[model samples]
Target: MSIRRRLGTTLVASASAAVSLLSAGQALADDFSYNPPGTLVSGSGSGRFDETIYAPGMRFPIEEAPAFLNSQVWGHGGGSGPGGSQCDVENFSYPWWDNYCETRSWDMPLCPSGQGHQGQDIRAKSCEKNVHWVVAAEAGSVTNIGSYSVYITAADGTRYDYLHMGSVQVSVGQDVEKGQHIGKVSNEFGGTPTTVHMHFNLRQNVAGVGNVYVPPYLSLVTSYQALIGPPVEPAVGSLDEVSCDAIRGWTQSPSSPEAPIDVRLYFDGGPDTAIGHPFLADLSREDLCTAIGSCEHAFQVPPPLSLYDGVDHVVHATASDGSSNAPEVANSPMTMNCAFELPSGVRRRVADLDSANAWHFSPFWDEIAVSDGILSTIDEGEDLDRTPRLVATSSAPETLYLVDGGWRRAVSDEIVGVAWQFHPMGAEIISDEELAALPAGKPLRARPIVLRSASGDLWLVDDAPGPGSTGPGGLGGSGDDGDGATPDGDGDDVSGSCDCVVGRAPASSAWTTVFAAFVAAGVARRRLARGRRGTRP
Candidate 1:
């Protein structure tokens, strides 16, 4: 046999042994049966009872069925009518009396038209004198009480309907204990004459839609077995935890590849035990770094991946025993990649500006790089100062342009910094003509910007770099002069109309020479600054 199959067999054997040991001395009870109106039967009745009688933690509704005939006549397990006719065998349907027997031609079964009775009919002697008291099978509130029906809602949200009731004694909203009398059974309506019986029915609402009938007998049997039996144990198996680390990479795309983190668990138990129970793994890139020195591990998960960033997810596994459990759970940290560059020469990234909002943004970003003053302020412009103005942007239509921040035109700048308040996009360098057409408070062609706060509140900032200044230039540049020409070199002015320079070095030697020159210049400037400070002192 295969190893997995052998392991499964062993687990099953072990669990079965445990259950047998636990229930060794206890005897399972037989299902309850009503004595027909007339019959005589005898048996040794020595077989393991498979029928269930009660649910766990639930009580029987009534101590006993109410007396319908004289006490002696009721207790004999059967009854006889006038002239020595067998009453129990007379009116009782086939299958109840004799499995092979067929209904008499003159008699009508409960399901005469073949509609098939949805509920079982427990026959009563008479509708008037018997006074069949209806009781609740479990402790529940009387959710609905009417003359013809009484509905009891159990703690587990199951509703029991005792329909065709003569008159309800319980009122709506009444708290009823288990076995409390709610009403009396009567077949005064909804069935043919001489077929008086309590129509017990069970209906379950599927997904908040309509109700479907489930046999009451089946529910009763299952519930009864659960109550009397030992608690079912859950199965156990292998548990796995997976995670990913996203670090800065060579790619210009928003996503960057980092390290893989994984942990595996081996278990020896039942497989089904893990259902509904969450398996948790708390992992952080920092933790992995501390443990392994490098946050890299073998990939237990297959490629063409789905999850990104920090690695926390719930996992389900089947055990050797035909059972299953969720053995692995992972939680990833909130991360954001600011590698997205827009047409306006701006870059955008998300950050969990507030620690309190960590839960809100954790699902989207892979890594959150922390720095001082990543958040910016709101610039509502001078115009909307008196009015409560809010800025909002749609990620669609354009990658980072502002949609509305009380501005007429779209923001033509890339987002530079983001915070809970205002996020500063790139600076808007407008000409004197564009600035002059502003209506005092409102600037013409205002750069539209939207800012979202930790509280989910949105604001609009127009014509202002709300907080942080421009981002650092390309590697060769220092401050604003990086875009200037490189004298005595083949470096041409690649700066676009926006005054931003894009430089390209020769495939072989240009980058090396340029880098060395910048380094030398930086060292000389540092010495000069230190000398100036010392002279001042």
Candidate 2:
């Protein structure tokens, strides 16, 4: 006889026995009960009892038997016996067991060793011809798809395994919609009555058994919900500049070579509500670099200068709280400036300039004090003689000619004032020929190059040539001028007298008188020369 016929006969026999037991007043009050409920029964012997004999309302949980069968299928406890005795249950019964037996040693004879069946089996009736199609319970990415079995893992980490399938319809990594057909039920195991049925099981942690087994029904429900859930949206927010003080005590050392210079949105903005908490968002160094317009996050300012000199940066913060009511916070633009060096070796002032000090460095003229006899304002103003000076504007390769003689160049440790370097009118540029034609070594006094005004012009003054012609000696005119008196090489007595008086006799001596007389004479000559130069027009 076919397997289906055998299953049909078994069901009929069980039903008849159940009806007879009720008539005889031997029926139990439980939903489903066994003859001697807790005792084990043998598969081949007369230990078999009809399932329907216990209760009128109780019926097999599954409508049909599993299409696949295995002899090694046994209860949680190890057991073995004839005609797949493992199918029989004992005193302690779970909702899943179809039959019970007394001998713990009764194991399913059909299943192969080392491949023990993990799920339960149902009895199939011969008249039930259609094998139920296995379907996915939840929505998720199909992690593993196979011809005989298919497995899916939900985003929440739950896993579902479907075994004994004929043809898997989906491929690995495919996103499966809920309730999709995986495959049709196939063959059974061992030499049991060749019944057409399906065995279902739920396993957790495919990695190991420390994972608990959930009921097949429960798993199906959960998988169904996972596949149908709505998609998640990304959160948004603002990033703000952080004070150095906030990170002064940070313990985790940054792996990057650049020190931590910027406060990220993750660090500056509070927590993201979408993710459910505040996190140092996993941002790549490239992202931060693009945001800051710098090569590295941790930048080093020149010694003593704590201020940052760079473009203003804006950080974007996202809300973490799931509430739609929360608004995104954005940080105001933070401007960095060059830092100042302190007297002590400790570099302190390297920080963002306060709002009050964010003025742009004009390419025009401004008066600045000289420190240690060195001119400090080179780009902003011309030399004292009103000549145009060439100021190095930017590090980029573009050449900026001195318009109206005002150009500034940042020289080593000082802003060297340029003069007499005017951009010729109607000429878009000043060529190398023109630059060379101008004074080579002489300082060119220049009028501050102004689009509109010319207040900060610089003038190139003629100073005597020689070792003593530059710096303190050249400027103070203390060196000898070939003649015995103070050096008056430029014929200017005002600067020469001061130099002459130093290292000389007191005010009352003959040398003092001689020096005064000579200085007065030199002053008259200088005034005449200057007047001539001024009136040359």
Candidate 3:
């Protein structure tokens, strides 16, 4: 047997060898119930009850269901004390158990006693070994392989360890996708066999602490729910209205009708598609109060500027109750046809003179102003598009500016890189004179687009990059159809891990380098508007 597995079984089994696993209480599969975190079998020691889902959108490791997630050593199996066959019917049943912090001697800071089992042990559908397959829980590259262990490390540095498996199909340094098969479950612990099961571990760096193992039961439960449909119906609500001004809605859980629920609004697609955000349904509504005995069940937020582009933008509102199943509000998927047109013949371009680039926008360009205050005779420049791409200046490469409605608004690197892709070296060098002449408007702020990760958590992602590409002379330069923006509304600033500072330019369009999948960090709100257009320096 593996050194850790043998140590774990000895510690946990000897402590509770006389206690039947059934004594923990019977949990039905339908209820998806389980003992609360830290509620281990008697003598197994306490477990970590931390509820944070460190891994969102992870895939269930088992390739198929009928597999049971219960204690291997403490169950009615042939190990320390109980002499029942490991294939007993009770061994392959639900609800799942939390053995992450079961009794052990390993160094585990997250555990209550500072040392315990580092992961959860799961039994396959039956007692047969080397038949049930185990797959990758998240997309990552295989970093290590042992005689009976495999480790995959994600791009973000989170490591996933799978042990006690046979027929290994992956080698060290091989990239694997979530749900991809790695090997079959077996009792292969070096040269000795322990029990027919798979042991899984999650390791990542935590602030104020070094790399360590975290609780994985909650993440496994979420992913398992995704694998099998939710047992209960999702919360219900209504998308009361979707107007040119604001989108309003109300949501309530049948399980708890009087409590206000959270809702998410998606544009042009379901929860998995397009841009969306979450709004609290805690606003008061007399109609809802009369119907459900709760007044604080309404949600209302102004329509995003992206949806007012003279087209049908479908907005769907669904309850966000941290469940796999997401039920849309009644009258959902309503269309928001708020048309905001851009002025025709507006000249928008990055005027380049030497290494300096100036982003200039005007309703009508009567003439061109080049170096030395010379009004040079130039042909008609290109017109600005509806949604202008974000840009930066050579002088201030760290800051990205959004030009819209005849105004230039400073955008943070968070929005420029992670939320929406922009050229790192996309800043155009403009003369100081031209830069001072451009007017600054309100910061280009908009509501964050909420995205659901593998762990079933809703994260606020910023908007996607706009319609145009950057060129040799900066944005809208030669060989690319550069665009500009118009219109505005209120939204929270985004936060992310990618810095996206100006550096080497990629050999693609301006908005080609997408820096996606970052958690939203709320930036301090800036003043409503900055310097006005044409305001003399």
User: Which wins on TM-score, candidate 1 or candidate 3?
Assistant: 3
Between candidates 2 and 3, the TM-score winner:
3
Candidate 2: tens digits of C-alpha lDDT, residues 73-106: 3332124433222222221232223322222343
Q: What are the RMSDs of all candidates, in order?
A: 24.8, 31.9, 16.6
Give the poorly placed runs of model 3, Cα more than 4 Å off: 1-31, 230-537
Give the worst 10-residue stretch by lDDT in candidate 3: 512-521
Instruction: Give the TM-score of each candidate.
Output: 0.28, 0.25, 0.44
Strongest candidate by lDDT: 3
Model 2 stretches astray by more than 4 angstroms? 1-95, 98-116, 122-130, 188-195, 206-537
Question: Relative to the unseen true structure, what is the Cα RMSD of model 3?
Answer: 16.6
Tell me how far the alpha carbon of residue 409 in candidate 2 is from the true structure, in angstroms, after superposition: 62
lDDT of 1 by residue, 1-537 (tens): 432343244332233333332332122233223333222122211111122221222333322322121111121222322322112222222222110011222321222332233433443322231255667766567788565667887654556777666656688888777667766655445453322345555555544334544334433433334333444443222222322211111101001113221122222222122112111111222333444343322122111012221233333322211111112322211222112100111113223244323212221221222112222322133322322222222212111222223222222211111111112222233432332232121111211122334554333322332311232123211212121112112222122241111222123233223233333222111212222354453
Q: What is the lDDT of residue 278 in candidate 2?
A: 24
